[model samples]
Target chain A: MDCYETRMEPGDRLILCSDGVTQAGLGQKRYKFGWRRSGELEFAQNIIRKSPEISAKDLAYAIAFQALSISPEKCTDDISCLVIYLRHPRVLRILTGPPYHKEHDHDFAMLASGGANDVIICGGTTASIIERELHTKVEIDLNLMKASGDLPPPGMMPGIGLTTEGILTLSKVCTVLEKKQQDKIPLAAKAIINRIMENDCIEFIVGTKVNEAHQDPNLPLELELRRNIIKRLAIILERDYRKKVTVNYY
Target chain B: MKKITLEICCGTTCYMLGTQKLLQIENIMPEEWKNCVAVSAIPCLNNCTSENICGAPFVRINGEIMSHASVESIFNRIRELLPGEGEE
Candidate 1:
């Protein structure tokens, strides 16, 4: 075995593979291009180049799958690929609920827009505050909510990472984290959970405002206060997931 | 009555290019065609690369790829698919 070492900078990706991937499609008539075989290396490079944001595990799967797909009839070797993506630690800031006092709406909006790499605004009213203060529009595509099961659709705004309905989405996030049943979570909650898992530091801006609609007895018992839900999320993220969490209530 | 599925790409590359405006397509869609269209935002279509990143803001209409997509262009394609009365 030959060993080599090189300096890797942040945002660099390292891929290690077995001979199966490199030698795939060798001597195959379909892969013949003059004298060269259209091997898995080319296919892996194409997948990586096209989907630069792909996770390391997904990259490995793609490379191995490509190797298997090429000349599956004569596949005799075991294919293996390992990918390591190096990057700086990321911080995710989540803004949920609305400020208790209407006077602090601008303050809440400014904090949200203040240079966070990943920002998630949960709650329609919370999003509206940001939209009003930042002069940006939050567009919620109702069609995406078809499978969300009573949860309002997710919204998108310029310069914000993610926007979604509050309490319900947070409840789903908590459920998915505790039960590990990601398949049953709604799309918006799934997106939020995915973002949370990817980051090292989590900062939550928990607005203290209480929506009277949630207090109705007709609603599900799980529809608790936003502050309580965020507290639960912070606990799970910090204690269970070992992430650095900071929650500031306005 | 089958509705045409329209998936607007909201990936970082596509959003920066102009998909943000396309998210409002529902607002401007013809009232008669509203029932026939289903629109959603997808994270990425994986059609973008360093070489062809300029062709971003892509959308899928009934699983068919449409690059350099705009709300107007999407409406045109939907018209071709549905061809409602009085629509050119």
Candidate 2:
């Protein structure tokens, strides 16, 4: 195999494909008399030129779909196209539950204010602590709350990405992530899941505080401990979605 | 009776001005009018031009644009449009 090296800047795209794509439409009537075998390279280049903002995944799909469409009636070799776009990794920090010790609240808030590109505060008490320590008001969207159905609406803080109710929202997120049911997820959970999908790295700051309300027999079975839910979420994100996940406890 | 759809603009300009206060319309609305009005928040309505920016907070009552919208103004407009009222 010949080796070549090139520097890839942000927003640059690199495409690799199997020979099947290049050899596609070879025996078709349009190319029967021509020396050129296929139009795959020109087709992909045209698609790339047409859509400057097209994602790597979409570009690959577009190329592969074109190859398939060129020879729809015949059984051909496996056609695969992989496109890699170079960009900075996006980091999402999720702050959930309150710390076991009250003294750690300030430290937690300080950590939240650190350099993560996106920050989602998950619990009501957790948000209050951040608001008190960061001196930023958390405005709960009443309109979103009403539209959220059973779940509480998300909130907006000055610098934070999203603020939501803790346990219930996380539980719904876990359910949505596990079941892959996008249509049935609540509004707040949908927002969280959307952010999770957009970012490449996920950092979870879980507080060890145990809420006694969750232990009540009257509570639903899915209302597990905060840490347990976070663990499940991290597992699903890492194992299934192949995301980089880190869990830190305060 | 057809319920009146009230969409409040929660875009950046409107939110900064006062959409948060107007969002509480559902909680503070009179019980009698609750059945007739349906309030929801939507993204920018593209009404924040140089001419309309001063009226940052805007709302739409049954697709009619209302600039400089407030709880009281919305109520008065809804009162005017309610069935058996002006209906226009």
Candidate 3:
């Protein structure tokens, strides 16, 4: 029973291993390379020597392979390594429905059509409006959407990030967002929601023009209005995820 | 040499239920961890409606989902995985 309390310092190297790596085969002239301290270090240095830029994951695999190759043809114990790294972020902007009046259409279209930010157009009508206003094309991707029932699948515009069904999908997204169940949501919803969560500041560009025809008479009282749903989502992003939720109404 | 990506849920339900308070963690996080653990805000982590029903205030350590997250809870977890190497 040996326990060393050495603390970790930059440039310090440490390795932990099981008997499989250090054990010697009984009654044989063979001794594992990892059986000795020098051999073990040499093994690791050789990996780094071969590829100076190898990632942690690749390095783990390289060591594991060497350990297993000590007796390649047959039995060896389980071997493993853990490597980790940090990450960074971005923002998400969703442009759904349409502007309240036709006059704001040009400005809304121009504002939402620009690049350098991830943009999502939730409603089919909104996508068309943006397409017509900007003279860009929107191609619907029928195969990629989730279980949207009557709503059409997601679409792609010339410069926009994503385009999908409006009311039906938004309602489902709100449900999933409330439920916090990522898998139950469809692909389009999943992508947007994932992006929303993955970022520090998520802005929603909501087109206030109400689409009365798409509303289902059977909808629950809460899901009936697009404004309410978008607002509720904004509140969640603000309160729950702690993201900077900006609602820009067109 | 491991970087922990701490993803906090900023979705409505979590926020409404008080997850907003968790945001302060960014300020109090040990300076050394700022480089090791990159904390980011996410819209929703889905603990509210899942079968487990862990409720609001959720986060993800790397890709592992954690329900009912808090500053103390998250700090303890991060500390375990990355105990301070003397405040770099």
Candidate 4:
């Protein structure tokens, strides 16, 4: 074993992929997602090309799943990705819907805006309500984060905040939590999950208010209530990461 | 010999109220007592709040809750719980 040391500059992404990613498939003849025979480099480059500002969790998934997407008969190997982000203090606040009743919007906004360094809005209507009530504009760069089907990319809310699809993304996040698997998560959920992992303390201000529009019978059971998803995520964060997770359901 | 699992609350409130100083208890412990105790920092016991009987600066010894915890209080409890040991 050789011990090597190198200085990492800012904006550096170190991708340490296992052989399953490098020498994947049958010889050099096999590659997935339209990459050259030099599959490993191009494969990773492809994921990065899709979303250059990709989170560690998502990037790994993109590669691993693509490997799996290859004809299973050809690709057979264990995949593992160890991502290390230089470690920074992150305080993320996730705001879902407004309070169950209309009267509590004021108090909801107050607590919702409480003490988090960063914010992520899970619902479109919730963003509108926050915009109206708090007078903050929700601006999003769709190109920054790719959008999945029926779900738009995460948008920004001017000041240290981002917004995502309500039931659609929340449903995906819940599945990630339930399955206890982080791979192949939806883009928005992957971003939030990675953000959560970046932070030491996280606050969740979930509105107990249920939206009739979101009560679609065709939706997944957990998607019906954002509160349920928030609570469940809180539990996982606390139990798994041992982070200071405070979920104040307003 | 009975062992003690001590969980120190590092919740925001408790951390603000002086949880850092509580680590000193482990340092001042007698060798015999130190060997029997395992101290770990807990994110939040969900007990510290402005409106509850439990607030920050908490310590739990073998699942025993110690609210508004202090080095003196925790040591006193340890002395009481120590097997066959009497207060010095």
Candidate 5:
């Protein structure tokens, strides 16, 4: 973040964004959310409309929040901004990231552990991992943790990279569960099937290397294996969702 | 009555990794377990991937960490935690 300057007029609406907004990852190229002030204004309007009843302060916060939420790795630079209600919008100046911790009320830990809806399962290798990591019997804690926001969010994982495959996988899986429950599938069956499927997936998946390796020579076998696993998952997801799954290597 | 709370981080990596589906875990809960569990969304927890290209999109369960997670794993973990749920 560069500087926070503001000039208040009667009904001037202002908007600001961090360097991250301009540095979004588009393959090797970096791009801004919007190029021009008009476009930025429209982006602001979209942000305002994203959530109803949000005040201007919260709206600005959400814009920043959502931008960062795009990808942790993608946001190399810090983001700082100051929007003023002036006759016309102005950049003032753009800053990179925050200097120090201000009010991140939406702490990552709180969201990961105590979010609105969550599921915790215990079985097979996954159960073993949970037991090993948390040092508790998977059987006892799975349900307890699922029912309670006693855990962290998915991003806390150690390795896995954020990829299109991962995103689609999440969407597809959520769709399956939502539909299954709506159709009154037996909880036991759902759990059993889910456990069987999830146990095969490696935790802390590192997709960036795999993504890069696909194009570059000397790809590691481990990276290839991860890609294959994700591909299989995508196929299963496609079957589950009855849609064509697209996997982006990059 | 056992009280439980689950927070799903909708962070970029988490969202991409299918943590979004964790948001729907509530629907699958048997009526009996509903009252005991609470779910919500969170921002960031500073849990980074070993390699930005490789790691990310993790989750924590009951103060326990589950990194590089997936929807299937998350679902499985939740089923084990819910009351009267899990493999027989």
Candidate 6:
């Protein structure tokens, strides 16, 4: 089992494990593995030390990966994992770079300089491009390099479907912006949207609400842009997939 | 002669388990079967919660679900369905 301790607000507790724990001691045959893990708290703690860096979600997967590495050879043993966390946080990470030109530098500098928690643009030409464009440094998730050919349209990322819920979930994770800062949104989104439109999986949705929302004076420009961008992205996603896209405003 | 059509679901669950790569069936098939088989892709079979979701890496042939939708297995199945000289 993988053990975790919550360090952030909204104190949460989590336990992760390989399928071994679930398969080991359960009376029922069907989904018994899940139920057993649900009740076994102390046993879960015995497997690993507290992790201060990994989130509850990542902790679970990390444990699962660790177990897979150590498990007996030649046996599948139903490798699995269990994650328990009181609450999950809404996280948004935006990456931008590979400047178009030395004269026309590009980066998600708008977000970085706007008081984002992390700044990841590399030093040198990459950092220079971002620095020239925006005010602050944003932490870069190096893992993004693994991303392959053109990103799928707005809601077409792997494991994300075209359903209303899926669309809403993806929208929540992505940072949106008004057309004014059109240059600020991730290039991947635009590339993906173009492909989605090409495949007829989605279409543009523009109406008084979307138009008016961007015009709202009460909301900050960033917040307003954030809100409407999601709507536009959703309309495109729904149109292409031929489905209803839903959103939850918090 | 019986023609075969293969359809793979790209649904959320399947997609997460790496169904995008499963779409290489057309390329994997032998040269001769190209004219006899038609391969297509769709998003979501709504089979997310199933335990087998992780293994699908799934194909539907003539409307029948083929389990363990691996590249090798699919190649064999396509071969079996090809129009040929006689009974096996």
lDDT of each: 0.75, 0.77, 0.63, 0.64, 0.41, 0.42
Question: Candidate 3, residues A1-250: lDDT per residue as tens digits?
Answer: 9877866554434566555654423223566343454555687788767865445556666666666666456535556544332223356778886788989888888767564257787765577678778888666442332343333445577667777656656776777877878455666676667667656677777888654423323223333577888888888778877888888888
lDDT of 3 at B31: 80
Which ranges in model 3 have alpha carbons more than 4 Å from their true place?
A: A1-89, A145-151, A214-223, B1-88
Model 5 stretches with alpha carbons more than 4 Å out: A1-250, B28-31, B52-55, B82-88
> Per-residue lDDT of B5-75 in model 5, one digit per residue for the tens?
56554433454445545656667656875686665554433454434424445567766667666656765
Candidate 1 lDDT by residue in tens digits, B1-88: 7999998765445655677578778888989888999987654465656556667778999999999898778888888899554364
Which is the better candidate, 2 or 5, if ranked by lDDT? 2
Q: Evaluate model 6: give its TM-score.
A: 0.33
Candidate 1 CAPRI-style tier: incorrect
Report the lDDT tens digits of candidate 2 across residue range B1-88.
8899998764434554666678778998889989889887653455655445667678899999998898899989988888778844
lDDT of 6: 0.42
Tens digit of per-residue lDDT, candidate 4, span A50-69: 87656677777776776656
Worst 10 residues of 6 chain A by lDDT: A156-165
- By DockQ, is 1 or 4 better? 1
What TM-score does each of the candidates earn?
0.64, 0.58, 0.48, 0.45, 0.28, 0.33
Question: Can you tell me the CAPRI class of model 3?
Answer: incorrect
Tens-place lDDT digits, model 3, residues B1-88 = 8688887654434543455466556777778678888776543453544333334557888788877788888887887678463364
How high is the TM-score of chain A in model 5?
0.25
Model 4 pairs whose backbones collide: A100-A209, A140-A156
Provide DockQ values for all models, in the order shown: 0.03, 0.05, 0.01, 0.01, 0.05, 0.01
Better candidate by TM-score, 4 or 6: 4
TM-score, chain A, per candidate?
0.81, 0.72, 0.62, 0.57, 0.25, 0.33
Residue-wise lDDT of candidate 1 within A14-91, one digit each (tens)? Answer: 888877777666667765531122455466568768987777888899877777777448677767889888877778
Report how far residue A83 has shifted in candidate 1, in Å.
Answer: 0.9
Clashing residue pairs in all predictions, respectively, total 0, 0, 14, 2, 73, 15
